[model samples]
Target: MPASAAKSTIALIGVPLELGAGAAGTVMGPAALRTAGLRAAIAGLGHHVVDEGDMDVPHAVPEFAPGELANCRNLSDVAAWTGEIHDRALSLLASGALPIFMGGDHSIAMGTISAVSRFCAEAGRRLVVLWLDAHADFNTPATSPSGNMHGMSVAFLCGEPSLTPVLGERAFPALAAGDIHLFGVRSVDAEERRTLVERGVDCVDMRMIDEFGMSALLRGILDGLDPETTHLHVSFDVDFLDPELAPGTGTTVPGGATYREAHLVMEMLHDSGLVRSLDIVELNPFLDDRGKSARVAVDLVGSLFGRSIVHRPSPRA
Candidate 1:
């Protein structure tokens, strides 16, 4: 383990939220990750790992009018989960332990990143989100063809007006579009793409990766951050991996990061020591080929936390 990672405390928060997606099995994502030894993997890398169990949706939630946000699937359920997730995430961030939000789907990010943005603002730090996914989740209610909340999470985090009430009465600092960097994206809706361009979201799609290479593109992101004042949040949707590598995710896109490429990304992140929070989302065990995807996720996380083949001097040292 790198010196920066040694003896660090890591909190694992399971969110069994599948309402944001169009699939049912994503509800089991947290369990699959646990079954794959997520705790042991991090602990083995010399971190103190705390399993915070799972967060359940609030039973009583605000009721919305029938025609209000009607296109969004399971609006009420997602609202309940989002509020609960935001509160819990805020508490976790304040605790000084690095939190890894194990997710039911990418929608959980709406809460996690919201909490991060708020924390960064209060702490006088800039929040930079590195969105690792096959799709740029920049869809709003009006732009989303499927109206899945998972697809709309980034927009909500970026302060899309219509979805503001999803977090209920809580006022979280919305992320600036320039602070978001979408990586490994190969699939994007037409309107979502337009929105991403119009909003000036930094999207490093597969074509860009092929041209510039992952290390160069990723370095361009990491090197630009002012480490002293930046709170880096990495939202890693499992579908960021090639569907052939991680077919267990609900929204699998074909051309995604390769195994070695994924490890390099993790290793680089570990070297940078800029990551303060993480989200491992969109793993559906029911669709997994005998837990293969879960194991891969665990391995990548291991690298992220400093599980390396050989010891390398810390770059910051």
Candidate 2:
């Protein structure tokens, strides 16, 4: 059979995180996307699909009150979710299926990405992260004012200290600075910005996208990827969309990537065929204009799986 004729399996795991942001509505992300038929939609593309449902994250009735900078209000809940999802993802991969985590919050990236990294590492494969977000999420407990774990997810994934323990006894999945690529970033703390620059992470900010054109900048990004060399994880934050299109996101940023630009990125990713995992994070349907944000998210996932422009999951030869 031809390589392109092979089909693949995709498992959906939802992570609803209301503990990581100020706007307080992302916990509903999983259900929202699900209600929008995230599962059936992907399955319709002719891939094997399994809805693992949502991970059970306990409420964070804090044992101790949190401080200003140590904003660990829901530390236990987030940590527990991290542990459970890590194992869940690993378990799913062991079943020979790719995992697509429907996120509760951006903080959950710690678990979802870490699990995929460990899986690839054990299999002697390298992992690449395509971080699509408005903020860098590279803050540390010491540096963050809000201490929202979501704000600090990227920093921890790249081997920063303070919270690697969330991966359980096994180590957190850390990456080489060059392996992680950040796109459409418009907001960054001064310290996080400095850290990202010092570490040499590939960040194509909104200004860079505007200056160079999305297609040109994206070409450079795609050219940098060696599909044969990587298992890509795309972490798409709802905030990555302009508020006009995805208003459900808690951290709505103005002047985000337009709908067309967003689709182009997904299409390129599909063409590369390097994506092995995905995350649809930070959708706060409470703020949504109907179900517009969730629909767009589903559409983007559709593009990643191959829509009219790209085509569904092809076999890895």
Which candidate has the top score in TM-score? 1
lDDT of all the models against the reference? 0.89, 0.80
Q: Once superposed on the true structure, which residue ranges of model 2 sit more than 4 Å away at CA?
A: 1-6, 58-69, 309-317
TM-score of 2: 0.91
Model 1: runs farther than 4 Å from truth? 1-6, 66-68
Worst 10 residues of 2 by lDDT: 60-69
lDDT of 2 by residue, 1-317 (tens): 21112357888888777777777888888999989988887788788888888777654332323443345546777777777777888898778787888878898888888888889898877788889999998888778877678888898799886665545476755888988889999998899888988999898899999999888887776665556667888899999999998999888889899999999898777767677788889999999999999999998888777676534444332
Structural similarity to truth (TM-score) of each candidate? 0.97, 0.91
Candidate 1: pairs in clash: none
